[model samples]
Target: MNKKFDILAIGAHPDDVELGCGGTLAKLISEGKTCAILDLTRGELGTRGTDQTRKEEATDAAKILGIAERENLGLKDGFLVNSEEYQLEIVRMIRKYRPEIVLANAIDDRHPDHAKAAKLVSDSCFLAGLRKIETSMDGINQEVWRPKQIFHYIQWKNIVPEFVIDISEYLDVKLKACAAYKTQFYDPDSKEPVTPIATKDFFESLTYRAQDLGRLSGVAYAEGFTSEKLVAMKNFDGIVL
Candidate 1:
């Protein structure tokens, strides 16, 4: 599909987006803005789930978030690097989707791949705008496109947010979306070995974290984001008091 998206969220692993900005995405989609997700890896190396299970879970999460489309780059899990080849692949998706805004992985996180994917996606966003950087899809040359803004979502770390999106109405949707990754999350009866994210505490932390961000922002629930460049607002009217 050649349809343009209002925003595109890219993550190093399948559940990263869901953990990071699923609430914001659900809020945006509910407001009629189209969004898509691009997963850099299938989370093949995740402790609790296989690649096939993650893929299925991702699809299910996308539906919950009302994503227009979801794609996996099939990049190696846990081995992401900011290489030209990998950057070009990301560039192609940027050009193809032509999104005005791009949501990306946290700059630094517990997982090294998260930081690596952040740099990879950020570089690709810049390179995608250069006319000389040629890229093609489906035997057709893609047009040069660059997102106007790139916002990194909070993940793992309690990095201070540049801004927060009120997601009180969509928090339930976000939780449901996250729950799609059954194997990756807390499963009381599972035989899989426990991982960092597979504990009951991690599952409950999702709600509490959002609630904490909301408390700081004076909202019932919220999601946080950090921008590489200063954010500009048209006016003070949109600011939530």
Candidate 2:
């Protein structure tokens, strides 16, 4: 996967991206743009499933999304920290993929790791551009690289978005990708331990939230994001009617 990516979505856990911005990703891929996902952790601490189970689920989700690549860093779950070690690990991926846009975890969320991972990725994207800060992978030196934009997807919180992507057509595809994580989401028959996300209500919120965002933004369904820097549209032609 040496080819540069159009977008790279980073998450605190295996299923975070699926829950957050899967619709936008699906829409982008359908438009012929290349995308990738980087899970900062294997979601090892989730009550409903094992790390291995989550990994398999992540694979299924990635396949459903039709992303170019899905990689996990195997970082400690539930204990994410904004430190040099973590930042450098993410820096390597940023330089390796050289994506144009980066979608990251929410700036603030119900889980502390979400916010921490958000900051870690934000800083790494900046550090990856520093020519002096050296990093090597597979015994080869990596060239400095940085994404043109960083956007944090809305998670458990409704954090007012800087913008929204009209994903009305791809909402079904996103739901399908999320359903791939069987053990993590709503399942009436399975006897998995009830986690905050495993509830039926949580499953339904996925649709309502997107619908609400779309309603406010004059679309049928949409995914909202907060941009670190102002995004400029080349012209009025890009605006949704």
Candidate 3:
């Protein structure tokens, strides 16, 4: 197997990618589509675990999900901005990975960083295609590269999804990947102070949410996503869910 990836999922913090689209990613990788993850921050501000622990957990989750690569940009936790500096950094990654499709954070979510990171990634995808942008790494100019599509994964909010991938068979895989972050999700044994996502109800809601979307789309389980531009297909038959 090659080390390069076909899809690169980006999130503002660790575990965001898994929570949002871990099943979809696992499903793709199962079919031999290479996958990678790029986390903008180490989630240092998280209530449960330290940055180092989160990084290690992310690594474990990546292995479980079979991702080709996982990287953290080390951006300041809870304080990332959409500036030229940040945009260029994202652009460089986009070019480096050269993914065919880019999965990014939701456009609107409970966390402010999600939406901001989504825009930053979306803009970088466009900027990466511009030869005049003049991006360089290690003193070598980079070639312009843009992903064919950018899909915004749904998270924390119930906005209507443009499309949904049936993840019924991969649900267990997704749950395991999410559970790798023991300090973040529901865990009765944990002594750490609980947060909204750390509650048992929140964990149950995550499953029900996928089921609800699946019910609407006539699937057993599915992950939803939104598209900034109108998505098209060869014909109606090409539509799935």
TM-score of each: 0.98, 0.98, 0.95
For model 2 the local lDDT of residue 91 reads 95
Q: lDDT tens string, model 2, 1-241?
A: 3359999999999989999999999999999999999999989989998999999999999999999899999999999998999999999999889999999999999999999999999999999999999998888899999899999999999899999999999999999999999999999998878888989999999999999999999999999999998889889997888
Expressed as tens digits, the lDDT of each residue in 1-241 for candidate 1 is: 4569999999999999999999999999989998999999989989888999999999999998999899999999999999999999999999989999999999989999999999999999999999999989999888899999999999999999999999999999999999999999999999999998999999899899999999999989999999999998989997789
Q: Which ten residues in a row have the lowest lDDT in candidate 2?
A: 1-10
Q: Candidate 1: deviation at residue 2, Å?
A: 3.5
lDDT of each: 0.94, 0.94, 0.91
Clashing pairs in 1: none
Shift in Å, residue 232, candidate 1: 0.7
Per-residue lDDT value at 173 in model 2: 91
Q: Give per-residue lDDT, candidate 3, residue 231.
A: 82
Alpha-carbon deviation at 30 in model 1, angstroms = 0.5
Query: TM-score for model 2?
Result: 0.98
